[model samples]
Target: MTSHNRRKVRLITALAVGTSLLGLAACSSGLTAAPSDSSAMSSPKAGGNLRVGIVGGSAKDSLDAHSPVTHPDQARVIQLYDTLVSYDNDHKVQMALADKVTPSADATTWTVHLRAGLKFSDGKPITAEDVLFTFKRITDPASPMATATSLATLKRDEMTAPDAQTAVFTFSAPFATFPDIAAQYAAGIVPTGYDPKKPVSSGPFVLESFSPGQQSVFVKNPNYWRAGQPYLDKVTIIDFPDDTARVNALLGGQVDAIDQLPLGQVNVVKANPAIKVLESSTGSWLPFTMRVDQEPFNDPKVRQAFRLIVDRKQMVDQVLGGHGTVGNDMYAPLDACYPNNVPQRNQDIAKAKSLLAEAGKSNLSVDLVTSSAAAGLVESAQVFAEQAKAAGVTVNVKKVDPGEFYGDQYLKRTFSQDFWFTRDYLPQTSNSGFANSPYNETHWDDKAWSDLVAKAQATTDEAARCDLIKAAQEIEFDRGGYIIWGFPNSVDAHSASVNGLTPDKSGIPLTSYGFRNAWLAQ
Candidate 1:
């Protein structure tokens, strides 16, 4: 057996200490009747359909994991497919369908071995062909997925499968984050010739039915590779684009849980004695991007002036309700490579006015477009416009429907509100949001900054890599398109009876790391 298999064998062996293969029981209902004993409550019993609601759902939701744009679409991808690798609750890499991921000495080559006897939901063996196909599809230029840009370093020609169980990747240069890239939802593994709309999942659950802008249902996968898992028999994901409606669903017990709990309604949930509130720090941020290619914002001093006038603390306190940390322009907090030493940018209207004067724009009227796509986003924009008045600028606020924000308003406007979900890898976050990335909404392209990011990616030494990343972040902090004001903690609410739900800041709450591990209390 290979080293990866050996490690998995050891883990399975450790688990064998308590229960035999047949000792694990199965259930067929949404909730099974637990024994009268209180001890039964502490242990997970198989059974129950979990009904979950999420914010920001629309008819445009994509079943294709590689191209999902909204929060609900992202959450559904996690339920319907498994990545080559995945992260644990603490954001550490953990083996999933992939039994092992070994990198070469220079980090240019990576070898992936799938677990033995792995099978898709349709009972076909999951092999190297599937893994390679996933990479090729994600990197395809025509693909609308953000991952196409995120995995740009990967070359299709260098990807090969030596055997049915083994997949190999050879990069032109050292790319230490290949594993991180592989683990992302966009790179989720699917069977060869798999169809996104009617996907056959190898994950803990199988998609039963889907209704656009309505709800999607998933039933447990009995043949799932992970034994004795997915205690819940089914998961019903309901769409609620409106915050009040979503929260009301949870409060009325119509749904067991809700994702993206609005900060304004957090107190309302808290008041309910039967609701369990869970919060976790996330790298998620709400930022206003200024298109440097635009007229007034084309001037660097004006951009700097705009950044200086915003009160980040006030936004964090009033908008986030103190459930978040102040952001310093660049994204990726809670990750190891985040540049913590960069001096915090505080509100300075006098300095901003001086910068505006230097830019020959001492008097300016700017239109700030915003949406309610994320909580506090529109409010933050309004507060920022008020704050900029002290810098001798008139800021106009234009509101659009949250649904149309990402599709129409964002990137199309010279200045607009955008929110990014937390990505575990700092380099991935930087590549997706900054460093000449296609998603770099600000259109701030700097060769020197890109060079620094390249160096950081190629560096093998942790300390050296961190230094390079820090330098790149410092450049963005000084003059990037994003004015990151707050890193909000991901907050979710579930019924008091819902068990095993953990806070996840890696993006979508409750489901990003697989909600199959959760069960409804009996």
Candidate 2:
């Protein structure tokens, strides 16, 4: 094996153990280790259209970034819209649409400068007014953007575009991680008068034709600000909700690449000499949430009991096929700002039963709702159910359709399974699934946790922010309702002829994988 591949395997092995040991030897664990950059693997040739297949998409998909979450929606949105900032393959934040991001002296205000001479695909001049509109739309109560809660601190009136190039954002409280929040996919910039029915975007590629579940086509934007980028003349994305069909399409050269490759099929993809497997660890995690506001789970003892019974190492090894690292009930596994001081929670059936007995529910029979909608949830749920039996807990697994899983079944179920994408910032992770946030699956709201997040958000000192986050994570480790057992490594398979596709551990296919930056070797 090459020295880089050997080093990567060693790091993954170390991460499996290091996460269980409270981040020991994990500072640089999987963060620095990455797959070989395909861009560097071959000379760039930009002409042919690339055909990409993806799992987890349906006919109901739309261009609306907030509603109808699907793989195709995610893959297609980046082609049409651009976030202010996005993480590179190495998980480092880089400018996309915004030229400069700066903070005020008190950290309560932020200023953003737009790149000059930028234009939407429709030839409309891109300006700071568009940035303000994007933010205001998400924060608007009637909007479907899930990121509204993240911007709750900043009032719409506090945002201003003094001129076409400059925009200012004033927050009710200090927000040191504003740039990270701006990097979210949901924060994609749209025109000041954006109409979902008729989309206007400023990304590398412009939407040519969209046919929901069947296919979508994008042509290179001639007016794109980044000169000579989007090497392909055209890009085509097909919806392949069926895993087998997606793999078959890639093997048959029906498509140039595929995303969201299931772990069970990794061997099958690798067996094809014409195909190459690219893997990277990103913000991807599969976790089960127990609603703290509901019965049986309302009792802290029951929550603790559940945490004590599941074996994280077994989940990583068996379900993920050792393609992932252990999780500590918290997200942002790759972000350097994540707290590492919390004591790692391990499985103990005896202690779990004792806690259940103390909670007066010695014979607990609960239902676990998981769906095939997200990869590995059903398998992980089955494994977790088997492991929980040792603690005298009877778990019933209910699997549902992947289509309805995200929108209908996931957060609605009391004890449910779901998958989370990578978020580079700690605050973005926290806001999406913690405290009183709308998507808080577990319904866990604690003053101490919320206070720490607020303080950490406001604190500019890196040391102080880390300390506060560590303390908050400790509280969640002891009492949070999330069972974050494993962080799955993302695997994308593509034809050998395809080049410049950067595999990212952050798991964001569009920005992190450098899809726009990728070129087809003609």
Candidate 3:
């Protein structure tokens, strides 16, 4: 291999390890609530037409509680469905069907008390039975919720209800982050034995109709428990298949709000007087995934070598248009558990070459697989390939249908490198996304790293957990499960007249349309 290619290989290896350990030290690990900007959330307007945008078709393919694998159609379903608990714009967990939460003295068990009077969109009193049913189906052994890991650690048989309005959970272990799991979409509620295809829920909006790949309408639920809420009477969600198309739709006044904007043009909307931007930090980063079971990647030295070559700051500046923070190779600096003093890799070509030589190989060539929808990943992949070539490694960059990119064909097939966007607290991220065998699809297993993660999670001591998490991140970055580039400040832009839009607590856009509390200014 040329000296240039060898240099890049070394960078890939070193940076991958260096960043994971120290990257998150600067990250904000504390939970942030949704922005309560007066312009976005205040008093309710009661009723109006709220038009929104969807990036792709809202996957109306199924509404069964078993479905909801994507976010496209969730806004439609959120109008009709309700989890036992919900989060207000501020990200604070609030009682939904349940009134109060009381955990047993040991904290391993939690009893949820339901609000007295509530009804599903179908007018059925949303009793505790419905909540139990919804929980059971998703947690059933026959079902493997794509998003299961978010709520997987719980023991299913441990959930019981004393009566209709109250359910109790006895855990197999004490988990400090239990409540956080309840707020995810996969835990959405449906009636017992309800067909997984047709869903029923208790929330502010109801799915009126869906036209595949076009638009879906959600009508306000008059019986919604949130009084004086769901300000708008109807929400028309238009699907914009192309990124520019969505922006164009917003500019043309055909839609009032859109969730996505190309990274370069975020400034365009900021410059426009008509739009408002809301953004927050997230535990998400562009990951260069190496299935450790495969050749070259299976060898830690090779993986670490390639990882070292990545220039995190450069990737952030070039690919994200300078709106994001440079990734340090782990999850994000926001993860409290990330270490304060782990090694950070610098782009040193000689070091990369030496590492590759140590791995008993000289020539390195591989196909870099990327998804079509991940424009950022594709652009970054090209940059990575170009940089690796300079380090004496030839990278064949290939774009594949994103639909199948994460499936068995890509996960278990011929692809060598893949891009993955990860979201969640740092510790959970380390265990599920990077750890192997039962949780990690990449199958990377390290005894010491796993032990650190376990201690961090089981303890309620925030400071200790943070320290442990930081150590685990070190292991991940140094060992070469991934090379995280950075975290970008993600925001959604909308017409200024489309007042009352803010970033949600989780760094996602506020897409649900019953924002009767939000209205267009005259």
Candidate 4:
């Protein structure tokens, strides 16, 4: 046997001793409802068109299911296409279109079984060939999809559709967390002859009309795989780039609900009583990213000094309006494998100065690029600038337009701030912390960290994987480039007329933008 096969055999033998194999089977059910006090709410009655106002959209919006760059895009795509699996309010993997996904003994291969009698919006059968085609399209080099980085280890040549109901995928290494990957929003399935302009829906809604940066109208999919779902006859996602306009639309009854409710307007909307606010505690964070490959940050001491200069509690109180928990310079606070034992990092101005002095960079001054991209990003940057003065460091806060902030210089900026929703440890790291992560703003690439993640991914035992993940997290704690100050609560608002909207830990408002379950009260 090859060395990789030999290693897999040994791992299987060792894991079999006391741990069950990593074969997870999700029930063939629709999305689960988030925990809510629905005792007094009236039963859902179908037929009205639900309009939702969301922040952030531009002329660059797209209908591509594999890549959704903005809130509106994500909201629309999830309604238009279906992935094999999805996450519930607690961020647990739940089966969507697939009946069950099973892994091999060594976790190097995964077999997917589609739910029988599934059909697209056009009444075409959803076979295993469609699943294989979607994955191949995602990994195609000629046109790289957004989920390509996450599925980099997928062996394209080894993928096969054994029959109409079964599709098998082989990976280069043991991917015990393949289920989580399959649950990604960007991994939505598409038919073989898929055309972006004339999209086929495997989800609750079918696109009727789409105008980038303005609105997307979708009618209910009568053939949706889920039974008795999509209570609304239509869903209209309207993009309001300005927060004020979005909230006003909701209050003015122009829209049924709004996502990303500004912190300042939470009480204003609550006082009306005509609207109800939905709040979900999440692992989401807006972090200051320091590029480690560049000067000033290239030195480990400089990076540590920057991390030590932040007052996390103050950031949480002032910027988040006391709506979040303090962070410890790490992401994925809700991950099962999060290293809770790691000491919380508190601001130490004296130590920060000493570290800067040792790096021969005392009285350091750096421009902190920020924007009003999200609710608290610019405010946090301003707060951090004031706090850095205690360490004798000058943080020059430079505010930019939201559009320009995410433009060409987004990841290239020396020091900037960015936002992220709640994600588990491995998936979160794959997008932002790994060497080839497309959004690796810090440019942190460490072999030790990478190896630890690989081992954790291969390990089947939950406890063993947790141990490996903790070890990797410790390395990041010492030298990672992100100054994660706090995790803000996801806040959304909806008209009292709207029901079925529940809190979700995934950090996406309106139950991870789940419009399928929502219905308007007559």
Best by TM-score: 4
Ranking by lDDT: 4, 1, 2, 3
Q: Per-residue lDDT for 136 in model 2? A: 86
**Between candidates 1 and 4, which one is better according to TM-score?**
4
- TM values, all candidates: 0.89, 0.89, 0.83, 0.91
Task: Give per-model CA RMSD.
Answer: 9.2, 7.6, 8.0, 6.3
The whole-model C-alpha lDDT of candidate 4 against the native structure comes to 0.78
What overall lDDT goes with each candidate model? 0.72, 0.71, 0.58, 0.78
lDDT of residue 5 for candidate 2: 7
Q: Per-residue lDDT tens digits of candidate 2, residues 45-149?
A: 778899998676656677774443666776776677776765556665666687666666666777788878989889999999888988888778764265666
Tens digits of per-residue lDDT, candidate 3, 326-420, equal: 77677645443455476666666667767888987557888777753433767788888877876688888877643445334544543334322
Task: Supply the global lDDT for candidate 3.
Answer: 0.58
Write the residue-wise lDDT of candidate 1 on 1-522 in tens digits: 000000000000011111111111121111112221111235887799899987776676667756666666777777878877766554555577876677676767778888899888899999999988887876666643445554566777789999998998888777666656666665678888878878989787898999977888999987788777778899999988787888889999899998878888898899999998889887777888898888788888898999999889998988888989998887766557777888899999899999999989988998888876667778798888888888899989988765676664445679887777665334344434454354666777788887887776677666777778788888878877788888888788999888877766564557765677687777
Error of 3 at 335 (Å): 3.5
Sequence-dependent TM-score of model 2: 0.89
